[model samples]
Target chain A: MKRSIWAGLSGAVCLSALALSGAAASAAPRVELQTDPPLSQIEPFSEPVIFSLKAVADDGQPLEDAILELLLNTPPKTPWLTTDFPVVEGTMLARLTLPAPQGEAQFQQVPPIRGSYQLQVRVSPRVPGTFEPYTDLLTFQVPENPVKYRNLAILLSILLLAGLGGGWVIGGSQPPNPGEVASRPVQLVLSGTVLVAIATLLYISITAERAGAHTEAPTGQDNYTEPLNAEPVPTNITATLEDQAIATVGQAIPLEVELTRAETGEPISAAVLDINTTSLEYERTVFDFTAQTDTQGEFVWEQQFFDGAPHLVTVHVSPAANSSIPFEPFEFSQRIDVTGVAPPLFVRLVSLGYCTGVLALGTAAGFWLRRRSTQHAL
Target chain B: MYSSKLSTLKRAKQGVLSVPVQAILFLSLGSLSLWMLFFSSYPATHNTMHQTRHHTLGVGCH
Candidate 1:
């Protein structure tokens, strides 16, 4: 049970890492200088700069409760850049530890006079993981404050639309006119009013939906380091026969090979892995393995082999052309010497094998249920 | 007078033949009602566990 829990956690972390590795640069966490609205130029003293920095863990997991320390260079005219003060030495660091649920930190940095002040923001994680801290340096000026609009235009538009729609609906049933055909003007006016009301309702609903679209904190914003693909560049390949545990001459030994892509290290599926042996008996004993790759480039295979002699395992990795990335062929082998032990002697081994088979069957059933539902939807 | 009496008798026989047609219409209406009720609720009771999110991980694989 504990092993299973560890496996689940590891799987989650692996998926998170893979997702973040492909994230774009704009999604990365960085220090931003915020005014009431965005400013093109910064002037001195007139506007106060609000420093905001958000960090997400490298594993793509949220580091909810972490400490954010702020630092700023003093006096606005310290010769700190050239030689006197290094980046860390001249700045006074303030400890501002933020609690959980917010997972955000903001601070204000003001210089005596804004010439060219460098703002430093650092984030440290408080959880259990090997992660590098995040730091960003941003330079901005204190800009002149622009005249603030009272936002009366937005309010007036809303009220006008509402009043028009309400008046039409509250007027109730139209007067009956059984004696004569309705005139063109009356018909046109009625249709125009109804169309305008419908358009207004649709606009309101669409705007509300757009605003509600952003529900969760942005996962892609964390500056996740890209992965360096380590394709065990095959050097010298060698294999020797190790000790063997064997069954009857006709019985089959199952073997599974999983190959991942070289670039993203994601698993590549349906690529054939070959097995060679000194004797034809060993080679023919090899059964083809099943292939499947999950969302995070992971897969499993099931196959059986039947041979009493030493056997070799070789795996080749390949990817579809349409795939985002391709995998280079990787070859490795393990040799096993077989003694053809009697079937009566391995009761415990057989029982454990049965248990594993049961578990695999259960997993397959779960997958099948999901597949059927998807078909129904289609 | 005798011809008028015979015409009245033929009209009564025609009315008797229309009884089975009325019964057939009622049966058809009942069958239609049963079908609508049964099929409409079938979707409401459908098991959701059978739904799968697995397609060849196209763009959202990560």
Candidate 2:
């Protein structure tokens, strides 16, 4: 028993040492990317997303001869989109396709109405056994399109009118004569309701916006030093706003704050700024975040607002912890006005509801008239 | 002569087709027309349809 125990201990130690050596030999590579659509993500079902990616080695060298495969949530074994082309200038740009439906019960030609999907980007160095394969996942969103309401409204209206008209004509007390009365209030109401519905449907179809019809490409360069806020705060370090455009909901708001010294006119780099934002529509604990400026003495915060409410933001710029001089905190406030556009689904539903309610009343009136005529005939 | 005409009309009213059947047929036709027009609710992935013969049958262009 003692001899077997000693042999087992020696084998275990040998296996562990081999495992450590194997781990040290193989190392995962590093990947850095700056892409279009602001980030690598996109809104699904909207448009074909075009993006550029940058890949480099651990020593900060560009991998010019890298094999890349773009897969959509598929296993690594299945590579539909493969390229052996070198990533020249450490950058590669490609257009991603959003498939269109071919026919009924077909493969995924179009994206789902509402859901999130992962886009997997796999990169492998061409040099054999040098670096491990690197994969990155970018997520995108697809909003649901509510299209049932319009169809329901139209079909229901047609059914009601067909039933009422058939009953009225067949169950009438007498056939029309040349000297019969011309004006009929119930029939006139029925005609008017149907006319309104037809007009509404036409208007909706003409005004509705398609998802990907007007998708503009993102500017390929990153230039953060653009013109900013109108007002400049007077302090040891001043803040200048460079962006003055309205931000839409579910869209990125580029908040640029430029910092410069008042006395020496020198740019302050790596300074931290405290951002506190509050929404006017909903009151809650203030949302706070801290960000450091880049080498250009500017910090650009890309904020996305899910709601359409106005955000009142207060930014307090302060020096770094290792600064030689300590000054008072510079505080400034700005109001961000956000606008929300109703999705096509919401508009379709409201229009359908309005038309359906009016048509129901008209159909009821026709039915009453039909019943009265039938009693008189009997 | 009026009584004979009335009898013919009554017999025609009691013909082979019934009112309930007529109503059912009307409803079925109405529903089928709507289906052909507005089948907009589609699944994200259509592996089955794509494999089958009816792969290119898309609806709701207008």
Candidate 3:
């Protein structure tokens, strides 16, 4: 139950993070940054939490010689030790050690700030390099409960739709219509199905432990990190992600790959980016095939993951394309974690009941109409 | 003869309304009632947590 609560909270955090980042960045520099002990882990009055930042490039490469800057903001209500979140921003960080991979620069921040914290990573080329310094910006927060009772609110809406619709059919129908006789078989089937659904749901409700209602097995990916932006940039290959950060289970989650010239952003219509899905016994491969990009310089491969295992989608852009960017045969991968929570069985059963009841009632309404017409004729 | 003529007129009127037409009309009327009730009560119920929000409010206003 506690795990489920944690998962729900984390999933919400992930959603909000996406919302905060915006769908696409207009001109975000390639320097990627990640801070550990995600904002969700922050609470009021707790010990000053140290947010360790990891810096990398767009490709899966460790970024060295990066400079990190931090500013801590204090607002009202920082309690310093409690995880009650509404209270915890009170602890002061004794020191922050930013890793240069070769050297260290340290700093300290005062506790209990009420505003957002800003972290910036600036990467300077170390090896008498041809590359110029680039910067990436990240904003962190201890978010508030924006909308309380979210699930309960959605459930109320579903029930209202069902109730009003059901009431209409029930109140309108009368006997002695032709459809009443003709629809008997269908009515019987629907009735039986609804009864069975209701009984099964009831049995499960009475028997099954309530742990499934709120256990956190699969953590929500609301952890503030963008692998696409944080990964190491290969010398010659440039790849782009067609976002599917909002896909659900059993639905086709498409990752659109476009090979482009890093300097010009022009599509490499002839380049093929090979895809290999790192998942379960289902070692499926069309995503792994090397195919040429069309005139648009992009192709999409969709995978519908069934079970709740974290799968990494590894994409390798073939280095055959001619480009000014020194392309190494490096690969970039994103993990498709468990983000979707399937509707509970009880909710599904209620939905089934609504559907079956509607069908039967609609038939009855037809019969009632036919009977009225007959009466008028007589 | 007059009665028979009246009956024929009545039959024509009834004939104009086919089974499908009657069924559609009846169902439409039912749905309309539901829609009116739902829309009218939704705002009050949503805020006040009472399904008969309009009814109670109407009583108070009177």
Candidate 4:
């Protein structure tokens, strides 16, 4: 009887241990990505490159209903000439769904600039909480296009020469005369041109700011409160905006984010959250900051929108070291409308200064030529 | 006064280029300067004028 009892106890303990190990195994599913032509062979300003991705379980079986999100970021070191161009300096997002037949998906993008590109791949199940999400950061370099650079240099040189030649001939020939009254039409046209130029500059400045036109990393990895863990725990993260319709400039926009266990609805606390606001119109990241969720598994913050436009707010949650409940790192994004406002006085003044400086230089050159012409006449 | 006006007109016409032609040349120069300063894609030129592009023109560059 004593031997039978001991045997029964050992059997129950072994069964419990096996169940826990099985649960842990199911929690860790990995997504593997393969790039065609490989990353090393990618040439700048070349044709679009394809990225092939697959998600697999621990047993090496492909996960058919997996979704992959790819975030391609330009190198932080190099500044792009224009964010308006495709694949220039801003972040590009692509989504891929692995269908049943091949259990793989592909993404294609054209790399226009030459620099180190960081591609962040995040994989999760179609249905939340099936398994812990997986994220991988891959870096690749695109070689500089020597031909493009050479052509650019030649074109700019020609423009510079043309401008200088034109300015010299115009100034030398049409010297300004204080005694000779200018025609009414000529004066009108000159003033009109200056006004139009100033107005255009001001408009462009305001629009560019609203469009979030900057070439900087959306969010730096160093800003994270804690480094992401190798293996994240299974958790579901969700975020909501207080007023989803419209936000006003200079007003505080409230945002709330939470993390919880999908199965048990239990809150997960002490998660590090990276929040970034990107302007959709210009595809530029305007605001990026980091925060932590409170004990109740909630993070609430107020952000003041600078530009009036449609903005995407993205929250990336990662596990914190001292957290009682481990949680998987995941991203949540929401789009909101922001009302526009007039460009500040300083921006207008700067635009005016640029226009005035150009006009003044031209006027000064004309006067100098006029003095020399008058001496010859005398 | 009429002779003075005629002499002034003759002097203006005696220059290498006409007034209209000079105006066009000056406008071309202005256009070229604006394009190079604001819209040039060359890295060296763009990077060199990076601050003026951002602070003065309100064009966003990092």
Candidate 5:
């Protein structure tokens, strides 16, 4: 009787061990990425870099139905002309699929600028929830473009020389006679306008510089700071825009971003959110800012759209520093339509006004000098 | 001889007048060029001169 009992207990223990091993074997597969010409050899503005990627299961079989999403970000501290018209050359997004026969996919991209670029890749099976998702952040460097730097230097030198020589020649000419001066009222008005214009230009320059100084690049390192021993658990987070999708140019458009847990329908409060709006018509980033969710898991802000084109708005969500949740970071993007209107009149007037003022001052000085020299000759 | 000298000076003054004209011409050309290179949104022009616009001229070009 004792021998029979020992045999039955041993069989049950063996069966439980086999079930645990099977569960471990069915876990998510790993993704392997290789770059042609290697990432280290890439040069800015040179030949494009090719990436070869594959997803393989724990049993070493390639997962042919896997999908790969790639996002490349620009370098830090890039200065933009305006929040309305942003540069789009250095950033890109691509989605690729692995063919059944090859079991591997390839992507090619050219680096436009010299700096460290952050490439985020996410791999998931074709069928949702069939297998776990994998996320990876890879960084690569591209060397500076020497030829471009040299050309820029040459151009600047020519401009500087031309400006100096022109000023010297203009100053050497005679001036307008004081006795032939215009009416005092007209003179006062003109002087006042010029002074005000000069002050406005100065103010614009200073404020613009200060604003530019505040923009910093979003680094991937800061996005993912999970403890080394901590396991990455996927969070069921969903973001939705709760306002109208259409906006008018130069009018404040309300944007309300709401975050919620997909599983429990609970609000995910205090999460860090990064938002970027890029205009498809201009192929430029129109607006980008970072905000944190409130107690209700909502972020609300208003901005004036500058163009009458479709804009892509992307939101990236990450866990807050003090949060105990160890969820992976994710992003969502949507398109918003903007109705067309005439561009702002104030910017156009200011730029043209400043240019005209300088030209007029130079011309007036030249004529004044000519009169003075002619009078001296008499 | 006095009239001849006066004519020469007058001719020289006329030549000097062209200096201002030439100067104004240079000024206009430079202004237009700078605007196109740094400020204008001419396709590929801003991207090509991106570094110079930001580092040298301190113009914002992101």
Candidate 6:
């Protein structure tokens, strides 16, 4: 009896193990679906539509030898779906296709209509009896026809060309819109502001004379040669230069000084007039000169200049009072060298050209508008 | 007594190496390898669709 019971237990355990293994062997298969040139509900007509399919085994492993079919089954009402739908040749219905090792197995084709479409994939559909087939379905839309813009593009191009031609006709050599140039509000305001600024500067300059270093003396050296007691006491003195223009660097320049005796009210005869330069390097070397003034009571000294230098020359005049009369310090200066200091010629030319082009374009616009108004009136 | 114990150990090792035990291990290991190799997540399948869209747009599919 115990042997019979043991045999029954072993038989039951064996039966259960067979059942578990059978269930695992006959498990479900897997199917995957994909689309290429992906169906777009709203996209331009320039793009293409595509589809892809893949298959896997009961163990959820990709079944390489198994076949896959990517089917585009149209809806009932769609006239594009026909029995003569093209059959892909040489491609297996469920075969696993390898894409670039890193790419998807994709197929491309055009959609027949701009409407809803469906994609179906059947994996190992032909595998007889052993494993059930797997299928997947996907849906997407195709957009309607795009609106054409060809006419608008043409009209815009014509307008741009016409404007260019009108510019050429009105931009001929004369000043841009001469009438407008005369009437331009900005030009008038700018000129008025400049005049006011100049007037203010002149007023300040004239009033500044009072604050300037001034000495009083008689007008002529002969008046200074008279007896010292006869000369009137100078209440105010003024001196004027013969010229203000000086040459460029490395050029010799002459500076003249007019001195008036402070007490005499007339120019005093100077036994000697001396001119001295300050520490500022005006020339390669420091220079000092002394000379007797002409009857006009003017003393002049000529000196050479160095480039990019500032010079101050002081004129000291000795009067009959034995005291020297000082004149305002005069400065002579030269600009830096042209090669090192000047801007490139091309840049200046480009700026000038740009200005000229703007002026020409402005005139052209004005003329075109005037013509357009005249035509409208007629 | 030592020879008897050694014979018993040899018999036990043979039982461990029996055909039935090996069959169980082979099937389990095969199923495990298949799951690792081909039982990828559904996300991977969706990713492939995403990659296809990127390719159509001439952009990064990766």
What TM-score does chain A of each model score against the native chain A? 0.24, 0.38, 0.29, 0.35, 0.33, 0.23
Q: A1-378 in candidate 3: lDDT tens per residue?
A: 999999999999999888767633423335443333456765322223444444545443545665443323333332221111222222222111133443233321212233455555455654437345665555667543223235334434543444344333333333324524323332343354356446544544443335345546744553222345434645444676654555443344556778777777777764545555544223432123343455577765444433234556666665544533335555666666643333233433343344334444654554555556667777
Candidate 4 recovers a fraction of native contacts equal to 0.04
Model 6, residue A225: displacement in angstroms?
99
TM-score of 5: 0.35
Recovered fraction of real interface contacts per model:
0.00, 0.00, 0.00, 0.04, 0.08, 0.00
Off by over 4 Å in 5: A1-33, A38-46, A54-67, A72-77, A80-86, A89-92, A99-104, A112-116, A125-132, A170-378, B1-29, B41-62
lDDT scores for all predictions? 0.36, 0.44, 0.43, 0.54, 0.55, 0.39
The better candidate by TM-score, 1 or 4, is: 4
Q: Which candidate ranks first by lDDT, i.e. highest?
A: 5
User: Tens digits of per-residue lDDT for model 2 on A49-110?
Assistant: 33344455555565665644444331121012111111110121111211111100101112
lDDT of model 2, residue A325? 44
**Predictions' DockQ, in order:** 0.03, 0.04, 0.02, 0.07, 0.07, 0.00
Per prediction, the TM-score for chain B is 0.36, 0.38, 0.41, 0.56, 0.55, 0.43
- Which residue pairs overlap in candidate 4's backbone? none
Candidate 1 lDDT over residue span A255-319, tens digit each = 33444444455454434333332222223323222122334444332111222334444333444
Worst 10 residues of 6 chain A by lDDT: A82-91
Worst 10 residues of 1 chain B by lDDT: B53-62
List the candidate numbers ranked by lDDT, top first.
Answer: 5, 4, 2, 3, 6, 1
Instruction: Give the clash total for candidate 3.
Output: 34
Docking class of 5: incorrect
Q: State the local distance difference test value for candidate 1.
A: 0.36
Q: For candidate 1, what is the DockQ?
A: 0.03
Candidate 4 lDDT over A189-220, as tens digits, reads 44555665576556555655654555465554
What docking tier does model 4 reach?
A: incorrect
Q: Could you tell me the TM-score of candidate 6?
A: 0.21
